[model samples]
Target: MLINVCNLNNNHELSTTEMNGQFVQSQLQIASLLKMETTSTDQKEFICKCRELYKDNKTQLHFVDEFER
Candidate 1:
C-alpha cells in the first residue's frame, strides 16, 4: 500500500511542508516538556486559559516569560 501527499502552493509560493512538520515536532517536544501525556486532552485547560488571558499578547514577550531562557 502507498500513500500520496500533495504539496499545496498559494500565490506562487510553495507551502513549507517540511518546516511545518518540524514545527509540529517541536510543539510535541514542548508538550512533552510540560509532562503532558497527550497533546489533545482536557489537561490542555491551562493552555486554553492562558490563551484566553493573552490572546492578543505578542508571543515573544510571553515566550521569554514562559519558556525562553
Candidate 2:
C-alpha cells in the first residue's frame, strides 16, 4: 500500500509530520508484504530475505523516531 501525500501548492513539499506519517505507513505496508510472502513462499532463502529487509526497515524507523525526539 503506497501512501501518497500531495502538497496543495505547486511546490509539492511535504511537512515533517507528513513525511513521518508516510514513513510509518510504508513500514506497515512492508510488514504486511513480508507476512504475505512468508505464507506464500516455502523457500528458506526468501523468508530470510524478507526478515532481513523488515529488520533493516525497523531499525531505520527506530533511528528516525529517536532522532526526532
Candidate 3:
C-alpha cells in the first residue's frame, strides 16, 4: 500500500503525501522504518540501536512482534 521512491541525491526529498515540496521533513514513525521498503541507512542504524537498548527486556522483540500481529 506504500509507494516507493528512487532519488539520486544527498538532500532529503520532500514528502509527496504532505508538505508537497518540504525538505528535511521526517515521519513520526521512525522506529518502524526498518520494515519500510525505502528505509535509509540512518534509519537502519537507529533501529539497531533501539533493539540493543531494549534487548535485555525479558519479553523480547520477537515475542512482542508476534503478539502485535
- By TM-score, the best candidate is 2
Local error of candidate 1 at residue 61 (angstroms): 20
* Model 3 lDDT, residue 68, Cα: 37
Candidate 2 has an lDDT of 0.59
Tens-digit lDDT track of model 3 for 1-69: 232343336344545554433322333334356466754775566556656765887567675445434
Give the per-residue lDDT of model 2 (tens digit) for 1-69.
233443345344777787777778778876876777443345545445555556768876565456434
User: Candidate 3: misplaced stretches above 4 Å?
Assistant: 1-39, 58-69
Residue-pair clashes per prediction, in order, are: 0, 0, 0
Clashes of 3: 0
Q: What lDDT tens digits, residue by residue, belong to model 1 across residues 1-69? A: 122233344424635676577567767766766694554444355555656676788874485356422
Cα error, residue 55 of model 1, in Å, equals 37
Error of 3 at 2 (Å): 29
The TM-scores, one per candidate, come to 0.30, 0.37, 0.29
Candidate 2 vs 3: which has more TM-score: 2
Model 2 misplacement above 4 A: 1-12, 37-69
